[model samples]
Target: MKPQAHPTLILWVLASLLMLAGCASPSLEDYRNRQPVLVPDQFFTGELSARGVVKDFSGEVIRTFDADISASWTDEGVGTLDEVFRFDDGEVQTRTWTLTPVAEGYRAEAGDVVEPGLMQWQGNAIHMNYVLRVPYGDGTLDVRMDDWMYLVTPDTLINETTMSKWGIDVGEIVLVIQKK
Candidate 1:
């Protein structure tokens, strides 16, 4: 007698095939086409700004900073970025970033530092990430940043960020920016 086929095994194989098919990467052109329309004479101007709490090691907001970020990208994925951060108690910082296309996304550089940065359209969100120098012990410390910007409308973005180092929770911030 021939061996009988197992229905459960068949179903599991089918599901695995479907999952692999869904893992294909999106084309770079698809990325550009899907991006929100951000231009000058607008509110956001591809610029970023936010006012939110800056938390401490104790999970408390030890301070606050009002941040302003402006960036522009070229058609070929090469662009310049300007970010300004200010504290409520009188402190100011400015950073410039250079963005260039890499394997699938872009690499972000500030001064002599290099870090991974990504720009992607997931559902309706355009997310970005970078590293910043934070006041650690006797010198500046490197912290990973997960910066998120969501489009509530065609020209409006809602941003919230989380900063962390040593895999420890640091703080959270919220900001609103517009275009035209």
Candidate 2:
């Protein structure tokens, strides 16, 4: 006969595993010493172009798009990014983002955003979180977006965004933007 493990012991193990998972997430401070620091006010200005793909939860590419962005900044430090996207399926979408400088980062707002997003940057990377409304079956669905951007060169940046619903990842987008 074999001895059985106690129920309390099992619960404790599961709890410890969850805590470790949460602590494993990367923080902005981790990249503080990276090179080619990213400054939104400088990199996001002028004409830019992007090419990217959207992947579903299964990691299958569902759509591809090319976008043209026109970015400008005001004397007061307010920034505007106008984007027009053309998809392979002939769908066209437009979004405009207004970024206001804050003490530590920037407050970002867009037409399809459910609420304003907070953007923070350290070293060469920037991170932002927000809820975006996307067209669904008949109406729309609000999905949380976790966006990360890294400046690799003075004129090039890589962007990655994860879309989640109810704490579950639903899709992702990977793109590269280059100044024109």
Candidate 3:
């Protein structure tokens, strides 16, 4: 014969487990007042080299690429970053980003972006939110992208992006960039 647990005790244990499971990492707000505040155009200038990988939902690497990037700031308070990417599978792509300062934070515009993206800076990180149109099978898939960049050193930056479609997480991108 086995002893049985009370219903109230079972419910309490389950509730505690659920609460623990729902706990998540710190949000951008948590770093709002931290030190080493990030500045948009200041940290992204000059020539940089990037290596990145794209992973699928299962965390399997699907593609890898390297990019030659050049960032410059205009007198009009606009920053431009030109990136030329060469995929390991022999594909080449170019993307130009125009970043302009706004009242709240900054606005990012790119050819593949659905509209202007909103960027927020905190501590040594910059968070970007946007929707990107990805070409696939003669059509396009609109994916919501939450991009984050962390400055590790004077010339080293790390980036991570989460991609989602229809509110379902699809994949992620991890990249390391070094200034030249």
Candidate 4:
């Protein structure tokens, strides 16, 4: 039998790499100078809930989560992460944080439930990079997530998460929020 060639598979691999490369954000200062999202200081206040399902590479539903989050803004343009509760994996995890705004966006240090991470604002989006402490003999793992917040209205924001776990590219989570 002759050798078979698969151009489609090669094309798909190339396309995936291109998509990943597209996420390389420019410098924070210059990027922010252009068409910024211009979020208000008090944007994170009030009660918010996001519901979504997580899918794998094969487009299979892996897990579902409902995240309840609350925030308070301060005079220093600080977005204080008041609380976060996630219901998923047949378990509920609650996390509390204190956020301080740096040059770009905010840095949240979690007291419980989740590990601490840095969140930066780019235009209409917020990016999250953190280390996940997986429960295993394996050590901690690093993750980079781009969380984009799109405002459907003044009180509604949709959230999307595209992240890599342990330096390996996973899938993403898209959640729509409703304020309470």
- Relative to the true structure, how large is the alpha-carbon lDDT of every model? 0.65, 0.95, 0.87, 0.63
Off by over 4 Å in 2: 1-19
Give lDDT tens digits, candidate 3, residues 38-100.
677877798999999999998999999999999999998889999999999999989999988
lDDT of 1: 0.65
Ranking by TM-score: 2, 3, 4, 1
Better of 1 and 3 by lDDT: 3
Q: In model 3, which regions exceed 4 Å deviation?
A: 1-25, 33-36
Show pairs that collide, candidate 4: none
Per-model RMSD to reference: 9.4, 2.6, 5.0, 5.6
Give per-residue CA lDDT, model 4, range 50-76, as digits (tens).
Answer: 788776656677878888878677677
Question: Model 4 compared with the native: what TM-score?
Answer: 0.65
Ranking by lDDT: 2, 3, 1, 4
Error of 1 at 160 (Å): 2.1
Indicate whether candidate 2 or candidate 4 has the larger lDDT. 2
Model 3, poorest ten-residue lDDT window? 18-27
| Alpha-carbon TM-score of each model against the true structure | 0.62, 0.90, 0.83, 0.65
Question: Which regions of candidate 4 are displaced past 4 Å?
Answer: 1-40, 84-89, 111-118, 134-142
Tens digits of lDDT, candidate 1, 4-62: 87999999998897677646623333434445643222333476666666766566777
**Tens digit of per-residue lDDT, candidate 2, span 1-180:** 999999999999988987897698788998898979999999999999999999999999999999999999999999999999999999999999999999979999999999789999999999999999999999999999999999999999999999999877899999999999
